[model samples]
Target: MADSITVRGLSADAGQTPLLRDVSFEVRAGEVVTLFGPSGAGKTTIAMAVAGLTRPGVSLDGTVEAPARTGYLPQQAAGTLNPARRVGHALGELVGLRVPRMTRAQRRARVTEVLRAVAFEGDLGPVLRRYPAEFSGGQRTRLALAQVLATRPDALVLDEPTTGLDAGRKTELAGHLGALARNGVALLVVTHDPDVVAALDTRLLRVHNGVVTPSEAPQPRPTGATRPSVSCSGSPAAELRTVSVHFGSANVLREADLALFPGETVGLAGASGAGKSTVARCLAGLEQPSRGTVLAGGRPLPPLRRRTRAQLARVQYVWQEAAPSFDPRRPVEVQVAATATRLRGVCPGEALAEAREELAELGLTPAQAARYPPGLSGGQLQRAALARALLARPEVLLCDEVTTGLDTNLATHLLGHIDAYQRRTGAAVLLISHDPHVLTGRANRVLTVENGQMVG
Candidate 1:
């Protein structure tokens, strides 16, 4: 069988503007092909086009030839996974695509197999009973993969699959993808991370300015220098003292101790689901600790609901995945400016101006900012989220994978912006990221976590 996916003279348009033009690509059986490019360059749009999943306003101009069973894992998790549905149930539903009218026992067995393929372990019952909200970002991403793999597609297309995953999980996922390609499955990946490229025997295609072409190699990233130690003159800006957090019977965080001084950026490194996000949530008052204390400015911090406006304004959190955190009904520009207006007491006009300035620095144009979250690409949406968070000008910023979907140029620019802001305001920053490169020179100190405990 000649199982393959081919695109010729492909073009995609949104609201009369071309997002991708004259793009061409192919993925044959037992081959691995990667699309590498800067963010918002329409890499994801091409991926969606190939999978027959383009949005209503997107007009396709070229042919997308693929196998009957095509599995697609989109970059945005919000639209793909049902928040209300159990993870296992969602995977089970997708199983029907491959095995129509499957018996209950047969369906259960199939779901379990797919889950295991994604490195999900332990009892199937507990995993099936939990909602998507209960799982960490990496866990949710893996579950999404399982849902797609359950269909047993001959051609697998994934967009930013390693966005929120930890280093270990990324390696594991790369291994799985390599094994799948060896088994004669056609794999097409859209990503910017060189680490992903190092894991697979793949051909590189570059997407830029609405066009696609063959690339010799992945672009080299600029090296970041080590940051000099900054002096702390007063009380710590935020502190987590032997804090612990539990979800149901599972302990997600255990006796974790951390302190952030004014004007210093603290980088937290850990495997996905290793309590990094939980710590940030606790510090921002979004998640309550099961035990111990979270202090702000040397005082015990209250829960998010109990916190005052001033308290809330003192700390801000930028989510790992922007699309899920966004309000889909409104334009992203409005949401970004809302933070400044509500928290900083800036006029609506001034807030919008600041938002526009920040967006421009992150590579989003005025036109792109006018669109809603769903209309924007993954990189664009994540930049919008960062702009919104930075607009608050919080005393302590909790950024969880703020640069997950960004390209090197944009990521470097965003990091420089944050560093400049901290230097100007003497604010503390807790930057959580899977890439250690992000922490170099950016974070005053770096700490590692494993199995819910801080190792350094």
Candidate 2:
């Protein structure tokens, strides 16, 4: 097998703290290699090092060899996407950069090819005109992949490719990536999805606490967590009644009525681009609906900024994209503490203490919480985001795709924290996720969002 990418004696450290130590791996052409690990376990560090990348203040001593044409799909879609740019323009610009000599017509043709390759069925013009915010979580991921696919690289490194995909979409992506591997494209995927590992079975490497070693078998889906039961008999904590959300002319949610009962975990289940987050945003006061009302404790709730601090503190939302939620310039701990300080009116000193405790409960070390957003992995940042929200101690908690980036063990651990919080405060939790297993044992009842309506 022809080695498409190789790393020998790769070691990375941030100042004095080592992130990766003497890690080595190789991916051959027409083969797939999956890196498995928990969040902040040095998986992303190894992946980026192999792609010849390192953050500021992080030094690398690595001998990495890869094809000149290598496409990288980053874990955080926030950095990969430009909010101001249309999907077509972003992808077309990348195509021009990859193939500088291509004519305008050729670039357009190339954009169409990649769009179809990622998610679009036939005509991509409709999709090309929309912005990233208009798409669902899974669709935005596909748009990011299309940007990478436009480069036509010989080797591809994808981080958390299944972050926002449903089970059906995950299967489709697995088959698509498998096809790419079969067609002579070396694939080095950093993922926590067992299905992806099972589909891309050529090679497996387990990265643990900054060490990489060969994995003997495919990873398995998480199970066996003692799920908390929901036994709530009370009025709604947060309610969205006849809510209709629209972005420009596109209808996101139509007459979607959702209620979160006290001491209940409600799972919002839906396919890609089905407006699940919109329903959540309505309750959180993040998105002002085109019609209907959002209620907190049965009272009509207004948009954010206009609401009182108490209203803001009562309803908390942990968004799907965790990295962009924090300030990259400051330490993540300070940001997490600020949430409690500002929303709950706790003293800065006590809030910081509680932030540290909360972060630790979510599996992030006190040291990891002190680093900037860029230094932490995607899943680590997610737990940090949850900690930030939990510190507010809201009566209504809305978690949007919280466990998507986490490994099975880590996911279960994080879910356990939520379960603990719910039992302690009897808060209402609206968990928006694509995992069927998560919904099965955890949620008291599942609401399916399809065609802009909530049912069953």
Candidate 3:
């Protein structure tokens, strides 16, 4: 079979600064290829170049031969779907694009067929009627995959396809990708997920310092290691009593109770749409609880809108969707430094300096932090979000899927910093993740949530 995509000494530069350099690779029919690297290493740039998308100031050099029929799955899964349109309707529209002469009935049939091909086992009628936000994280990912596949592309470029999925769902997705390759669909995956790398037998290329070279596949980190010692003394840092939250007609959380003692790490685990995110949002004051009370520093916390700046600064939230947390129009340096200005009364000059230092610690350079959300990669945005939260010196930190886009080496390094902060400041942390291994040794106590209930 002829090669589906080919790159010969391809280099990418954003204005005068280079992102990728001297990259050459090929993906033949029925082959899976991955570009693995640390955050801000230009993996996404290469993927975007392969998918024939251009960045604002980024220019591509050298030769890239791409097939006419191609599909692209972006890193931000939620952005792939239309929020206002029903799932089935959005999918049918895409099918219509590929099969322009097909009738409405024919389009619906094609949508259903594509959904089934992506292994969507849910009831088709109700699921199809729901909007994109109504779908769980895993379901949203599957729907995104279906959207890409509905176009009937010969090659697919997926960026961080396995992020936010649990072990089982990750395995299921890997199996699906493998089967797709077997059916002669070439796949070029850009990710840092070791599990995803291990699940596929493919050509591995590492991108770093604006270059790509052949490399061995990365290995997963060993779990159940020694955890940081935390002295959980005095009153709990934060507490939620029988919290209940509702969105429209959906009961996202029902009478859920949780407590975070100072210096303790608590893990929240659940299936996608099982209310893990709801709890985190409630704690962060982003989502209001319809019933029950929240306490911070052993006192009843005020309403989210009524909370004072001090109260708000005490609890910081690192969003699971990193890019959305930052303003797209403003440079990230201003946005990140603003946290310190509001919470600590620091001057802009001093706050910027602090933000720069923290961002550097997380592997982001000053130049990278100066870029807007649209210019930075997913991992860089995630790190910047963490830096903003840490700058506030919050007493309670709520991390929701913050490390999903990170490579293993950087993820481990970032976790070490969080552990150190918790130890030094006696801050309480509530970590929410779908990967069981992420919580294995880190969390002092693990709670399992199901159908809006804290089952364990």
Candidate 4:
């Protein structure tokens, strides 16, 4: 069989900067090819190139041949779905377009089949009826995959497909991809998860700096390693009381409650789609509780739009996937500084200087920080998001899987910065992560969200 995908001398450059240097690879039908690397290592660039959706301002220099029938799961999984429509509508469009001859009933059946292939644990009824914003990161990843699989492409490229998934779910996804390969579909996977890379009989190519080579890079630093130690203060910095959120008929968060003490790292753990994000949005003022109150320092806090500048500055949130948080048109460093300047009335120069310092501590150099959001890697943007929130110097910081895209070393380094910042400023942190190791010694206390309720 002809190769499902081929890239010869694939190089990408953004003006004077090189993103991916002279990379060549091929994936045959029924093969699994993985591009494994550190964050900012150009994996997504190559994946984007192969999928024929290279970003603007980036020029490609080599030849790529992929099937007319191809599918791509973007690194920003949430971007794949139309936020206004129910997921069923999104899937039905693809099903109808890909199989124009199928009846509406047949298309619905096909959508259900694709959703089952991703192995979601519950009924497809609620998932299909709910809007994209209703799902968690991992669930969105699956939705994105289902969108891709709905077309039944000959070649599929997935960027960080296992992100936001629990350990068992990651393993399950890998096995599902393996099954897909066995059925003669080629797959190119870009990921930082070791378990994902280990599970496949993959043509493993390591990407470092801007080069792709066949040699392995250094192993990631394990979690529970040294990070400037954590310490907590007496009072609750932020708390959610009897909070409930509704999406149509879905009661996402039901009478949930959580408390964040100053100078502490609080970890929220749950299976994907268990309402962890609802809790984060409630605390961040992004979502208004349908019936309960969100309080900071024992006083009720309003929705984000209604919050005072001080309230906005006092509670900051970093997203799980930080790309959406940034403005693609502006330099990342400038945007990072905007939080400080806009929120605290700091002078532009001082805000920029503070952003530089915090970014430096998080391992982002001035040059990297100067690039636009697209110019930076997912991991780099994640750190920038953290820096932006920290620049606000909030009493309560909410990090939604802030290190999910980073490699071990950078993640460890970033964690250390959070620790040091907390020690110095007594900022309480709410960490939502699927990786148990990330919360092992990092979180001073742990909370669980089960069936839409918070349990300690």
- lDDT of candidates 1 onward, in order: 0.86, 0.85, 0.85, 0.86
RMSD in angstroms between candidate 3 and the native structure over all alpha carbons: 2.3
lDDT of 3 by residue, 1-456 (tens): 354899889888887788887888899989999998888798998888888886676888888777788899888776788888998888988898877999878888899888887667677887788888766666677789889999888999999887677777777788888988999989999888878889887899898987888999776667785255456667889989999987667788999999899889988898776888888878888777999988898888876688888998899988777876778889998899999999899999999999999888888877888988888988889889999999999999999887868877787777778888888998999989987667878888788889899976
TM-score of 4: 0.95
Q: For model 2, which pairs clash?
A: none
Model 3 pairs in collision: 21-210
Q: Can you write out model 4's per-residue Cα lDDT over 105-151, one digit (the tens) per residue?
A: 99989999888777675678888898888888889889889999998
How many clashes in each candidate?
0, 0, 1, 0
Root-mean-square deviation per candidate: 2.2, 2.1, 2.3, 2.2
Model 1, 379: alpha-carbon shift in Å? 1.1
Model 3: worst 10 consecutive residues (lDDT sum): 225-234
- Tens digits of per-residue lDDT, candidate 2, 295-341, equal 98878898997999889989999988898888889999999999999
